[model samples]
Target: MVSAGLYWLLSLAFLWGGFVQMGYPGMAGEVCIAFVICLFLLRFILVKRFVAASVFNVAATVVFFIFIAILQAKGMTGVA
Candidate 1:
């Protein structure tokens, strides 16, 4: 119930962010996909341990930065 709401909200956020990061198509798409993957991974490992949450956070952050790297590689400083 509550998680479903959260997922929709997060999906909206990711869509908006991904649109802004469109300069690097591959990286932006990968990061958005990673966000969704983390959401499911966390759900699959809920409550038994906090490890899944921690890993998701770290992976999401890394993916975001990787997207930035791709943007730079594409020479799209003004895109965002």
Candidate 2:
């Protein structure tokens, strides 16, 4: 499904950006926001299941945000 593909793409982009942001904190917030927003939009517009999609989206957002936040706050400058 398109929604599934978009979810995967958005998630991968978020993680990759977070990884890149290890050395560039300047882009971390933007990357996190973009990923989160796009992920939600994809779900809201394309997904039909209420509870299942909601849970999946929420989990992904929280995990991605935490991942980016930790990497940025720790001042990591390279992939770990």
Highest-lDDT candidate: 2
User: Residue by residue across 1-80, what tens digits does model 2's lDDT show?
Assistant: 44545556767776566666656536554556566667667667655655577556556666655765786687642433
Alpha-carbon shift of residue 55 in model 2 (angstroms): 9.6
Query: All models: lDDT?
Result: 0.58, 0.61
lDDT of 1 by residue, 23-76 (tens): 564565556656666656665776346555555555555554575577578764
How do all models score by TM-score?
A: 0.40, 0.38
Instruction: Estimate the TM-score for candidate 1.
Output: 0.40
The C-alpha stretches of model 2 lying farther than 4 A from their native spots are 27-50, 53-80
Colliding residue pairs in candidate 2: none
The residue ranges of model 1 lying beyond 4 angstroms of the native Cα positions read: 1-14, 20-51
- Backbone clashes in candidate 2 total 0
RMSD from true fold, candidate 1 = 6.5
Model 1 / residue 18 / CA error / Å: 3.8
